[model samples]
Target: MTEETAPQDGPDGPDGPDGPDGRAARPDREGGAQAARPAGPAGDPGDAGARRGGRWRRPGPQQVPQPHPAAKGMWRGDAGGPFAQMTVMPGRMSVRLRLTLLYGLLFFMAGALLLFVMSVLMANILGNVKVIGFGISDAEAAELQRQFVEQTMRQLVGRSLLALGGVGVITLVLGWFVADRALSPLQRVTTTARRLSESTLHERIALEGPDDEIKELADTFDAMLERLGQAFDTQRRFVANASHELRTPLAINRTLLEVALGDPEASDDLRAVGRTLLATNARHERLIEGLLLLARSERELTARTPVDLAEVAATVLEHSARREHDNDVAVHPELTPGTALGDPVLLEHLVSNLVENAIKHNAEDGGELWIRTGMLEGYATVQVENTGPVVPAYEVERLFEPFRRLNADRVESAKGAGLGLSIVRSVVLAHRGAVYAVPRPGGGLIVTVRLPPGQPAA
Candidate 1:
């Protein structure tokens, strides 16, 4: 038997028209009348009417209110912002004053309320009494009644006010004591915070009291400090490990490159490449050394030695004399005894880097390098100036940042890894010293460093 295939109910069905559901469709939308859809509710989604109709929803959580900017500054007692300079004057409303005023006001209000009740009762009792039994004229009886009521009220009010005044004085004295007690915990918190620093991180608030909000705050602060101490310790360990791990390989590479370059039978091309590689390797070593030194110098000094700033400057100049001569830079040293307490090696590095930087970036011909050291205002001071490209006053600050240089184009030989000033800053900070640089009027820089005076040399 011949099998007749039934028409599939698809877009092109036996019904002749195709639709999205594969059934007979209406005429093409552009050519035919379309069915109208029922209209939706009137207002836009977030409009007031929609909200009133319960069509718009609100967030499940109510947002917490933030303190006003003015209120924040007022609470912080900042130098500016609303209420920062406000006082309850005519009279100053200190915490104690405010508490005292509150106590007095409440006592006065209670006394006034009691007096009002007594006055009302007296008036009611007098008002209800009849005057016929006294045998006096109506006018006279009325006059007598009036005088009696007036005298009674005057005495009542006067005595009640006097008692209120006396109570108010007593309440004020008590309020002062109460206010002081209430603020004692806050005072403790302030004292603890003032005494805490990086060096004293082991100390804690240890607020011994009930589990109140202030106690909780103190505990949180202590926990934060503990975490900070741990983080700092970890960082120191990481820097030490990295210095050891990275320096060993760099030293080995330098040794290998040097041995290879030393071969007499090596080809010229090979020798040239070896020399370049060795130079690059040496630059990497200097960079690593600079980073390690910078990290070490940022930490608190554990041991200090008496180091003479003038001697350090003189030694650095002596070492750099050959470079200065080759670069056509004249070294002018004005050294005086300026002793500082710090790590001797780090101080030496600080001096050498400053001097080297001055030489490196000096004028191409007849550059003048001046290094001066002496005591300035009880500080061991070292000042270095060089004749080089002009430096802008604004860019002086950025020079102390790691890998930051005046010219964006970085030539390693010219800039020397851009860490000289940064390392100097770190060392200065480690020794509790200050370093600042100012651009000279012509074309150069005058960098000054002042270190705290050290103990007398033994």
Candidate 2:
């Protein structure tokens, strides 16, 4: 073994299981500055102890120093300090900054050019003149002329520079005010955009100014919002009408099937067929109900009440325990107070759908499910994790889309119309919450939803 690879121990040696700062240390692969024993080849037991010593050395290419995150957005022409500042994002430059710099530079250049021209004219005029005084020798006259020319040139240069400095300062100050005024409409546009949402789609920029580029932009933005509002209204109306029309027929069909199955004169085979029809009809009803709920949940909620997410999860678990038990899926819940402001019924539906999907698509035997609710990062959080077949990372996002399943085979066996996650996403969005799912390393998925906390009751 090389001397560098050989492990040594002494007072000056790498700290054993602790760092120089007296904290437990672990060897980092990047070889950061910590008192660690150098790491060696795999299956080497000494390397493990070296790692805990915080003195491990990595072999191979050195790691590059990462730039500070605050410095990442800086650009080539960005100003050095607070007085003159601009941010440069990729493919774009700050318009306000560009205008200010160009204004100041152009003014200074013009002033400098004017001074040069005036200086050249003055020099020419001085060069041709002589100091002609009575009883003066040619030498004396030449000396006096030289003095006049030197003094004139010096004064001209000094005064021109002072004037240029004053004018340049004025140009920069004016440029800032002018740029801000010219971009006032843009600020208004941004403010409106920040405040806009499904409920605030009716608000318009309505900029009152000259019919210039900024005004035109504001008008165009307003037109786009108008079109979007109309489209949303049309879609919402169609969904409402379709849901009512679809549900009536499904109800009638279910009633007819139940009546047929109840008939005493019905033959055994006929009764079996009637029972099958009833089951299929019930599935159709559920599919329709899911679609309707999904549509409603996509819209902004007009009314919100304080709700305990933990209680919602508890209620769902209670109702779903028997079903999970029948399917041999174990249910484990850690419910804590996670309160938020939302429609309680919709919150209940979100929890129920998550639990049902976890149980339904879980392992056929010895399945494990975890449901938890608590406060996380100042938000009410609900999380559900389950063990099932290996779910690919790429397919996790597709599960949230309507009528989408991991596999076509699962559509039949799981009896999932594939709208459970879709509804969950819609509800979460309607409540202004965030939902995420990640596949476990071994198998299954971990789903988490975070909603804003509710205000304390008066």
lDDT of 1 by residue, 270-299 (tens): 999998898788888888988998888887
- What is model 1's C-alpha RMSD? 27.8
lDDT of all predictions: 0.64, 0.67
TM-score for each of the candidates:
0.62, 0.73
lDDT of candidate 2 over 1-458, digit per residue (tens): 11233222223212222111110011221111222233333533334334333222221233211211211212111123111222223467678878888889999999999999999999999999978899999999999999999999999999989989998999999998898888878989977875576678999999998999989999999999999899889988989898889999989999998888889999999999998888778778888899889988887676777788877988888787666343588777666666767899999999998988888778877998877665543456677878888887567777888888787524443356888888987887666555666664457766766555675455
Q: How many residue pairs clash in each candidate?
A: 2, 8
Best by lDDT: 2
How does model 2 score by TM-score? 0.73
